[model samples]
Target: MKLSKPLIIGIAGGSGSGKTSVTNSIYEVFKEHSVVVIEQDFYYKDQSHLDFEERLLTNYDHPLAFDNKLLISHLRKLLVRQSVEKPIYDYTLHTRSEKSVLIEPKDVIILEGILVLEDEALRNLMDIKLFVDTDADLRIIRRILRDINERGRSIESVVEQYLSVVRPMHNQFIEPTKRYADIIIPEGGHNEVAIDLMVTKIKTILENGTELYYDDDINQ
Candidate 1:
Protein backbone atom coordinates (compact mmCIF):
# COMPACT_ATOMS: atom_id res chain seq x y z
CA MET A 1 0.00 0.00 0.00
CA LYS A 2 1.27 3.45 -0.90
CA LEU A 3 1.37 6.09 1.79
CA SER A 4 -0.14 9.07 0.06
CA LYS A 5 1.47 11.58 2.37
CA PRO A 6 3.48 11.54 5.56
CA LEU A 7 1.85 13.87 8.08
CA ILE A 8 4.42 15.10 10.56
CA ILE A 9 2.73 16.43 13.69
CA GLY A 10 4.62 18.06 16.54
CA ILE A 11 3.47 18.12 20.18
CA ALA A 12 5.31 20.61 22.39
CA GLY A 13 5.09 21.50 26.06
CA GLY A 14 7.13 22.31 29.13
CA SER A 15 8.59 19.65 31.44
CA GLY A 16 5.93 17.17 32.57
CA SER A 17 3.22 18.98 30.66
CA GLY A 18 1.85 15.67 29.32
CA LYS A 19 3.52 15.92 25.94
CA THR A 20 4.15 12.19 25.89
CA SER A 21 0.68 11.38 27.09
CA VAL A 22 -0.91 13.49 24.43
CA THR A 23 1.40 11.85 21.90
CA ASN A 24 0.33 8.41 23.09
CA SER A 25 -3.34 9.31 22.77
CA ILE A 26 -2.79 10.33 19.17
CA TYR A 27 -0.94 7.13 18.53
CA GLU A 28 -3.78 5.09 20.04
CA VAL A 29 -6.19 6.55 17.55
CA PHE A 30 -3.89 6.23 14.59
CA LYS A 31 -1.72 3.25 15.48
CA GLU A 32 -3.05 1.04 12.74
CA HIS A 33 -2.54 3.86 10.27
CA SER A 34 1.20 3.18 10.21
CA VAL A 35 2.36 6.18 12.24
CA VAL A 36 5.87 6.53 13.67
CA VAL A 37 7.10 8.47 16.70
CA ILE A 38 10.20 10.68 16.59
CA GLU A 39 10.88 12.13 20.00
CA GLN A 40 13.01 15.22 20.63
CA ASP A 41 14.34 13.67 23.84
CA PHE A 42 16.47 11.32 21.72
CA TYR A 43 18.66 14.24 20.69
CA TYR A 44 20.05 15.01 24.15
CA LYS A 45 23.84 14.89 24.09
CA ASP A 46 25.15 11.97 26.11
CA GLN A 47 25.22 13.14 29.70
CA SER A 48 26.77 9.88 30.89
CA HIS A 49 30.16 11.48 30.41
CA LEU A 50 29.37 13.68 33.42
CA ASP A 51 28.95 12.90 37.11
CA PHE A 52 25.70 12.79 39.06
CA GLU A 53 25.59 16.43 40.22
CA GLU A 54 26.79 17.61 36.83
CA ARG A 55 24.11 15.58 35.08
CA LEU A 56 21.47 17.01 37.45
CA LEU A 57 22.66 20.49 36.57
CA THR A 58 22.53 19.59 32.93
CA ASN A 59 19.80 21.78 31.51
CA TYR A 60 17.51 19.26 29.84
CA ASP A 61 15.14 22.13 29.11
CA HIS A 62 17.58 24.08 27.01
CA PRO A 63 17.04 24.16 23.25
CA LEU A 64 20.81 24.14 22.79
CA ALA A 65 20.91 20.77 24.59
CA PHE A 66 19.23 19.10 21.61
CA ASP A 67 20.65 18.06 18.28
CA ASN A 68 18.24 20.28 16.36
CA LYS A 69 20.36 20.26 13.21
CA LEU A 70 20.25 16.49 13.07
CA LEU A 71 16.53 16.50 13.88
CA ILE A 72 15.88 18.94 11.07
CA SER A 73 17.85 16.77 8.69
CA HIS A 74 15.78 13.73 9.63
CA LEU A 75 12.53 15.63 9.27
CA ARG A 76 13.68 16.73 5.83
CA LYS A 77 14.23 13.12 4.89
CA LEU A 78 10.76 12.16 6.18
CA LEU A 79 9.23 15.07 4.30
CA VAL A 80 10.70 13.71 1.09
CA ARG A 81 9.03 10.32 1.69
CA GLN A 82 12.07 8.67 3.27
CA SER A 83 12.40 6.62 6.48
CA VAL A 84 14.54 7.65 9.44
CA GLU A 85 15.73 5.69 12.50
CA LYS A 86 15.30 8.10 15.37
CA PRO A 87 17.62 7.69 18.35
CA ILE A 88 16.47 6.14 21.59
CA TYR A 89 17.15 7.95 24.87
CA ASP A 90 17.12 6.74 28.46
CA TYR A 91 16.56 9.25 31.24
CA THR A 92 17.55 6.76 33.94
CA LEU A 93 21.25 6.99 33.03
CA HIS A 94 21.07 10.49 31.60
CA THR A 95 22.32 9.19 28.26
CA ARG A 96 21.17 7.69 24.98
CA SER A 97 21.36 3.96 24.29
CA GLU A 98 23.62 2.74 21.49
CA LYS A 99 20.79 1.20 19.50
CA SER A 100 18.91 3.30 16.94
CA VAL A 101 15.19 2.97 16.15
CA LEU A 102 14.35 2.30 12.52
CA ILE A 103 11.28 4.28 11.47
CA GLU A 104 9.62 3.93 8.10
CA PRO A 105 7.85 6.64 6.20
CA LYS A 106 4.25 6.39 7.34
CA ASP A 107 0.91 8.12 7.10
CA VAL A 108 1.77 10.17 10.16
CA ILE A 109 4.72 10.85 12.46
CA ILE A 110 3.87 12.16 15.92
CA LEU A 111 6.89 14.08 17.20
CA GLU A 112 6.72 14.90 20.92
CA GLY A 113 9.05 16.59 23.41
CA ILE A 114 9.64 19.60 25.62
CA LEU A 115 11.27 21.67 22.88
CA VAL A 116 9.93 20.05 19.77
CA LEU A 117 8.67 23.42 18.56
CA GLU A 118 11.63 25.45 19.83
CA ASP A 119 13.35 25.59 16.45
CA GLU A 120 11.75 27.21 13.44
CA ALA A 121 13.56 24.84 11.10
CA LEU A 122 12.10 21.84 12.91
CA ARG A 123 8.71 23.47 13.38
CA ASN A 124 8.41 24.21 9.68
CA LEU A 125 8.44 20.49 8.87
CA MET A 126 5.22 19.77 10.71
CA ASP A 127 1.76 19.66 9.17
CA ILE A 128 0.27 20.49 12.57
CA LYS A 129 1.80 21.95 15.72
CA LEU A 130 0.13 21.61 19.14
CA PHE A 131 1.11 23.04 22.51
CA VAL A 132 0.00 21.16 25.60
CA ASP A 133 -0.79 23.64 28.36
CA THR A 134 -0.88 22.43 31.95
CA ASP A 135 -0.57 24.36 35.22
CA ALA A 136 2.95 24.89 36.49
CA ASP A 137 2.19 23.34 39.86
CA LEU A 138 0.65 20.29 38.23
CA ARG A 139 3.60 20.00 35.87
CA ILE A 140 6.04 20.28 38.74
CA ILE A 141 4.25 17.51 40.63
CA ARG A 142 4.31 15.27 37.62
CA ARG A 143 7.95 16.08 37.04
CA ILE A 144 8.83 15.19 40.59
CA LEU A 145 7.06 11.84 40.37
CA ARG A 146 8.53 10.90 36.98
CA ASP A 147 12.01 12.04 37.86
CA ILE A 148 12.11 10.26 41.18
CA ASN A 149 10.61 6.97 40.11
CA GLU A 150 11.32 6.79 36.40
CA ARG A 151 14.44 8.93 35.92
CA GLY A 152 16.14 8.03 39.23
CA ARG A 153 16.07 11.44 40.84
CA SER A 154 15.74 12.36 44.50
CA ILE A 155 13.10 14.64 45.97
CA GLU A 156 15.54 17.38 46.95
CA SER A 157 17.36 17.18 43.67
CA VAL A 158 14.10 17.40 41.76
CA VAL A 159 13.03 20.50 43.65
CA GLU A 160 16.39 22.10 43.12
CA GLN A 161 16.33 21.38 39.42
CA TYR A 162 12.80 22.71 39.14
CA LEU A 163 13.52 26.02 40.83
CA SER A 164 16.98 26.49 39.42
CA VAL A 165 16.50 25.29 35.86
CA VAL A 166 13.20 23.91 34.62
CA ARG A 167 10.94 26.79 35.66
CA PRO A 168 13.23 29.52 34.42
CA MET A 169 13.98 27.71 31.20
CA HIS A 170 10.31 27.17 30.51
CA ASN A 171 9.57 30.85 31.04
CA GLN A 172 12.50 31.82 28.84
CA PHE A 173 12.24 29.29 26.02
CA ILE A 174 9.61 26.54 26.16
CA GLU A 175 6.52 28.45 27.27
CA PRO A 176 7.21 31.26 24.84
CA THR A 177 7.18 28.76 21.97
CA LYS A 178 3.47 28.17 22.58
CA ARG A 179 2.66 31.23 20.52
CA TYR A 180 3.82 29.36 17.46
CA ALA A 181 1.41 26.46 17.90
CA ASP A 182 -1.42 26.05 15.43
CA ILE A 183 -3.52 24.79 18.35
CA ILE A 184 -3.27 24.93 22.12
CA ILE A 185 -4.54 22.03 24.19
CA PRO A 186 -5.16 22.61 27.85
CA GLU A 187 -4.88 19.82 30.48
CA GLY A 188 -2.73 17.71 28.20
CA GLY A 189 -3.67 14.03 27.72
CA HIS A 190 -6.76 14.25 29.90
CA ASN A 191 -8.38 16.33 27.20
CA GLU A 192 -10.01 13.55 25.27
CA VAL A 193 -12.06 15.94 23.16
CA ALA A 194 -8.93 17.72 22.05
CA ILE A 195 -7.28 14.41 21.21
CA ASP A 196 -10.30 13.39 19.24
CA LEU A 197 -10.18 16.69 17.38
CA MET A 198 -6.57 16.03 16.43
CA VAL A 199 -7.41 12.53 15.27
CA THR A 200 -10.24 13.98 13.25
CA LYS A 201 -7.79 16.39 11.67
CA ILE A 202 -5.56 13.54 10.60
CA LYS A 203 -8.53 11.67 9.17
CA THR A 204 -9.54 14.80 7.32
CA ILE A 205 -6.00 15.17 5.98
CA LEU A 206 -6.01 11.61 4.73
CA GLU A 207 -9.33 12.09 3.02
CA ASN A 208 -8.49 15.47 1.57
CA GLY A 209 -5.05 14.46 0.36
CA THR A 210 -4.30 18.16 0.41
CA GLU A 211 -1.01 17.77 2.23
CA LEU A 212 -0.07 14.08 1.94
CA TYR A 213 1.59 13.95 -1.45
CA TYR A 214 5.23 13.84 -0.42
CA ASP A 215 6.32 12.79 -3.86
CA ASP A 216 4.76 15.81 -5.54
CA ASP A 217 5.79 18.66 -3.27
CA ILE A 218 9.34 19.73 -2.56
CA ASN A 219 8.47 22.58 -0.20
CA GLN A 220 5.89 20.66 1.87
Candidate 2:
Protein backbone atom coordinates (compact mmCIF):
# COMPACT_ATOMS: atom_id res chain seq x y z
CA MET A 1 0.00 0.00 0.00
CA LYS A 2 1.23 3.48 -0.78
CA LEU A 3 1.62 5.69 2.30
CA SER A 4 -0.10 9.05 2.26
CA LYS A 5 1.47 12.46 2.77
CA PRO A 6 1.41 13.62 6.40
CA LEU A 7 -1.71 15.27 7.81
CA ILE A 8 -0.76 18.67 9.21
CA ILE A 9 -2.21 19.58 12.58
CA GLY A 10 -1.50 22.92 14.22
CA ILE A 11 -1.85 23.74 17.91
CA ALA A 12 -1.48 27.24 19.31
CA GLY A 13 -1.83 28.91 22.70
CA GLY A 14 -0.20 31.28 25.14
CA SER A 15 2.89 30.22 27.05
CA GLY A 16 2.17 27.37 29.49
CA SER A 17 -1.27 26.82 27.98
CA GLY A 18 -0.30 23.13 27.55
CA LYS A 19 0.46 23.16 23.83
CA THR A 20 3.20 20.54 24.08
CA SER A 21 1.18 18.47 26.50
CA VAL A 22 -1.74 18.40 24.07
CA THR A 23 0.59 17.49 21.21
CA ASN A 24 2.14 14.68 23.26
CA SER A 25 -1.25 13.44 24.37
CA ILE A 26 -2.49 13.21 20.79
CA TYR A 27 0.84 11.74 19.75
CA GLU A 28 0.42 8.92 22.29
CA VAL A 29 -3.12 8.32 21.10
CA PHE A 30 -1.91 7.85 17.53
CA LYS A 31 1.30 6.01 18.40
CA GLU A 32 0.57 3.24 15.91
CA HIS A 33 1.07 5.70 13.07
CA SER A 34 4.20 7.49 11.93
CA VAL A 35 4.08 11.00 13.44
CA VAL A 36 6.47 13.94 13.23
CA VAL A 37 6.18 17.24 15.09
CA ILE A 38 7.49 20.55 13.86
CA GLU A 39 8.16 22.81 16.83
CA GLN A 40 7.70 26.56 16.29
CA ASP A 41 10.54 27.23 18.69
CA PHE A 42 12.94 25.79 16.16
CA TYR A 43 12.31 28.66 13.76
CA TYR A 44 13.65 31.48 15.93
CA LYS A 45 16.06 33.68 14.04
CA ASP A 46 19.78 33.42 14.76
CA GLN A 47 20.19 35.38 17.95
CA SER A 48 23.96 34.91 17.86
CA HIS A 49 24.20 37.75 15.38
CA LEU A 50 22.67 40.18 17.84
CA ASP A 51 24.02 41.66 21.04
CA PHE A 52 22.61 40.55 24.36
CA GLU A 53 20.47 43.67 24.79
CA GLU A 54 19.22 43.58 21.20
CA ARG A 55 18.28 39.94 21.59
CA LEU A 56 16.51 40.79 24.83
CA LEU A 57 14.57 43.48 22.99
CA THR A 58 13.55 40.97 20.38
CA ASN A 59 9.89 40.15 20.80
CA TYR A 60 9.98 36.41 21.06
CA ASP A 61 6.19 36.37 21.21
CA HIS A 62 5.82 38.39 18.04
CA PRO A 63 4.75 36.47 14.94
CA LEU A 64 7.74 37.93 13.14
CA ALA A 65 10.04 36.14 15.55
CA PHE A 66 9.35 32.98 13.57
CA ASP A 67 10.70 32.28 10.12
CA ASN A 68 7.20 32.11 8.67
CA LYS A 69 8.32 32.05 5.04
CA LEU A 70 10.51 29.06 5.69
CA LEU A 71 7.78 27.37 7.73
CA ILE A 72 5.25 27.89 4.93
CA SER A 73 7.65 26.60 2.31
CA HIS A 74 8.50 23.52 4.36
CA LEU A 75 4.86 22.79 5.14
CA ARG A 76 3.95 23.12 1.44
CA LYS A 77 6.68 20.63 0.59
CA LEU A 78 5.56 18.39 3.44
CA LEU A 79 2.03 18.33 1.99
CA VAL A 80 3.50 16.67 -1.09
CA ARG A 81 5.56 14.30 1.13
CA GLN A 82 8.92 16.06 0.88
CA SER A 83 11.63 15.84 3.53
CA VAL A 84 13.19 18.95 5.05
CA GLU A 85 15.73 20.02 7.66
CA LYS A 86 14.27 22.24 10.39
CA PRO A 87 16.35 24.44 12.64
CA ILE A 88 17.21 23.68 16.26
CA TYR A 89 16.75 26.46 18.80
CA ASP A 90 18.38 26.44 22.23
CA TYR A 91 16.22 28.12 24.84
CA THR A 92 18.85 28.10 27.56
CA LEU A 93 21.19 30.26 25.51
CA HIS A 94 18.34 32.00 23.61
CA THR A 95 20.01 31.29 20.28
CA ARG A 96 19.48 29.23 17.16
CA SER A 97 21.81 26.25 17.50
CA GLU A 98 24.13 24.86 14.85
CA LYS A 99 22.38 21.52 14.62
CA SER A 100 19.37 20.84 12.39
CA VAL A 101 16.42 18.47 12.68
CA LEU A 102 15.79 16.10 9.77
CA ILE A 103 12.02 15.78 9.40
CA GLU A 104 10.39 13.21 7.16
CA PRO A 105 6.79 13.00 6.01
CA LYS A 106 4.74 10.74 8.21
CA ASP A 107 1.14 9.68 8.76
CA VAL A 108 0.68 12.75 10.97
CA ILE A 109 2.51 16.08 11.23
CA ILE A 110 1.85 18.39 14.18
CA LEU A 111 3.10 21.91 14.68
CA GLU A 112 2.80 23.29 18.22
CA GLY A 113 3.66 26.63 19.78
CA ILE A 114 2.27 29.89 21.19
CA LEU A 115 2.16 31.86 17.93
CA VAL A 116 1.40 29.06 15.51
CA LEU A 117 -1.98 30.57 14.70
CA GLU A 118 -0.65 34.04 13.94
CA ASP A 119 0.61 33.40 10.44
CA GLU A 120 -2.13 33.22 7.82
CA ALA A 121 -0.09 31.24 5.29
CA LEU A 122 0.89 28.66 7.86
CA ARG A 123 -2.67 28.50 9.21
CA ASN A 124 -3.98 27.68 5.72
CA LEU A 125 -1.82 24.54 5.57
CA MET A 126 -3.33 23.01 8.71
CA ASP A 127 -5.73 20.15 8.30
CA ILE A 128 -6.82 20.97 11.85
CA LYS A 129 -6.04 24.09 13.86
CA LEU A 130 -6.64 23.85 17.59
CA PHE A 131 -6.46 26.57 20.19
CA VAL A 132 -5.87 25.67 23.83
CA ASP A 133 -7.82 28.19 25.90
CA THR A 134 -6.40 28.58 29.36
CA ASP A 135 -6.97 31.74 31.41
CA ALA A 136 -4.33 34.44 31.61
CA ASP A 137 -3.65 34.14 35.33
CA LEU A 138 -3.31 30.37 35.15
CA ARG A 139 -1.09 30.63 32.10
CA ILE A 140 1.14 33.15 33.86
CA ILE A 141 1.48 31.01 36.99
CA ARG A 142 2.25 27.91 34.98
CA ARG A 143 4.75 29.74 32.82
CA ILE A 144 6.50 31.16 35.88
CA LEU A 145 6.86 27.73 37.45
CA ARG A 146 7.83 26.01 34.22
CA ASP A 147 10.43 28.61 33.32
CA ILE A 148 11.97 28.42 36.77
CA ASN A 149 12.24 24.63 36.73
CA GLU A 150 12.78 23.90 33.06
CA ARG A 151 14.65 26.94 31.82
CA GLY A 152 16.61 27.68 35.01
CA ARG A 153 15.16 31.10 35.66
CA SER A 154 14.53 32.75 39.01
CA ILE A 155 10.96 33.51 40.11
CA GLU A 156 11.57 37.26 40.11
CA SER A 157 12.97 37.24 36.58
CA VAL A 158 10.15 35.10 35.37
CA VAL A 159 7.57 37.45 36.81
CA GLU A 160 9.30 40.45 35.32
CA GLN A 161 9.43 38.84 31.92
CA TYR A 162 5.81 37.81 32.13
CA LEU A 163 4.71 41.33 33.00
CA SER A 164 6.95 43.16 30.58
CA VAL A 165 7.12 40.86 27.61
CA VAL A 166 4.75 37.94 27.85
CA ARG A 167 1.47 39.66 28.66
CA PRO A 168 1.77 42.48 26.16
CA MET A 169 2.74 40.08 23.42
CA HIS A 170 -0.15 37.77 24.20
CA ASN A 171 -2.56 40.65 23.86
CA GLN A 172 -0.95 41.97 20.72
CA PHE A 173 -0.33 38.72 18.87
CA ILE A 174 -1.30 35.38 20.37
CA GLU A 175 -4.74 35.79 21.95
CA PRO A 176 -6.38 37.34 18.93
CA THR A 177 -5.49 34.34 16.80
CA LYS A 178 -8.00 32.18 18.67
CA ARG A 179 -10.59 33.13 16.09
CA TYR A 180 -8.60 31.21 13.51
CA ALA A 181 -8.97 27.84 15.25
CA ASP A 182 -11.08 25.09 13.76
CA ILE A 183 -11.43 23.77 17.32
CA ILE A 184 -10.74 25.12 20.78
CA ILE A 185 -10.02 23.12 23.93
CA PRO A 186 -10.34 24.84 27.28
CA GLU A 187 -7.82 24.13 30.03
CA GLY A 188 -5.81 22.22 27.46
CA GLY A 189 -4.59 18.80 28.72
CA HIS A 190 -7.38 18.62 31.29
CA ASN A 191 -9.89 18.24 28.46
CA GLU A 192 -9.60 14.53 27.87
CA VAL A 193 -12.89 14.35 26.02
CA ALA A 194 -11.82 17.03 23.56
CA ILE A 195 -8.46 15.35 22.97
CA ASP A 196 -10.11 12.04 22.34
CA LEU A 197 -12.63 13.71 20.06
CA MET A 198 -9.80 15.26 18.04
CA VAL A 199 -7.95 11.94 17.90
CA THR A 200 -11.07 10.15 16.73
CA LYS A 201 -11.57 12.71 13.99
CA ILE A 202 -8.00 12.24 12.82
CA LYS A 203 -8.33 8.46 12.86
CA THR A 204 -11.60 8.64 10.98
CA ILE A 205 -10.08 10.89 8.35
CA LEU A 206 -7.20 8.50 7.84
CA GLU A 207 -9.32 5.36 7.93
CA ASN A 208 -11.72 6.83 5.40
CA GLY A 209 -8.83 6.98 2.91
CA THR A 210 -8.52 10.76 2.95
CA GLU A 211 -4.94 11.69 2.17
CA LEU A 212 -4.72 14.78 4.40
CA TYR A 213 -5.79 17.41 1.90
CA TYR A 214 -7.25 15.20 -0.81
CA ASP A 215 -10.38 16.72 -2.26
CA ASP A 216 -13.41 14.76 -1.12
CA ASP A 217 -17.08 15.54 -0.56
CA ILE A 218 -16.94 15.76 3.25
CA ASN A 219 -13.46 17.25 3.49
CA GLN A 220 -14.23 19.70 0.69
Give a tens-digit lDDT track for model 1, residues 1-220.
Answer: 2345578899999888898899999898778877888889998876667886686667788888888877877877876668887888888777778888887777788888898888987886788999999999999999899889888879998998889888999999999999999999999989999999998989999778765544444444
lDDT for predicted candidate 1 compared with the true structure:
0.84
lDDT of 2 by residue, 111-181 (tens): 99899898876887788999999999889889888888898788988888888888999998988999999
- TM-score (C-alpha) between model 2 and the true structure: 0.91
How big is the positional error of residue 128 in model 1, measured in Å on the Cα after superposition?
0.6
- Each candidate structure's TM-score, on Cα atoms with residue i matched to residue i, is 0.90, 0.91
Candidate with top TM-score is: 2
What value does the lDDT take at residue 70 in candidate 1? 76
**What TM-score would candidate 1 get against the native?**
0.90
* Steric clash pairs (candidate 2): none
* Segments in model 1 whose C-alpha atoms lie over 4 Å from true places: 1-4, 47-54, 213-220
Clashes of 2: 0
Q: Which candidate is the best by lDDT?
A: 1
Candidate 2 has an lDDT of: 0.84
Assess the local accuracy of residue 173 in candidate 1 as a C-alpha lDDT between 0 and 100.
Answer: 94
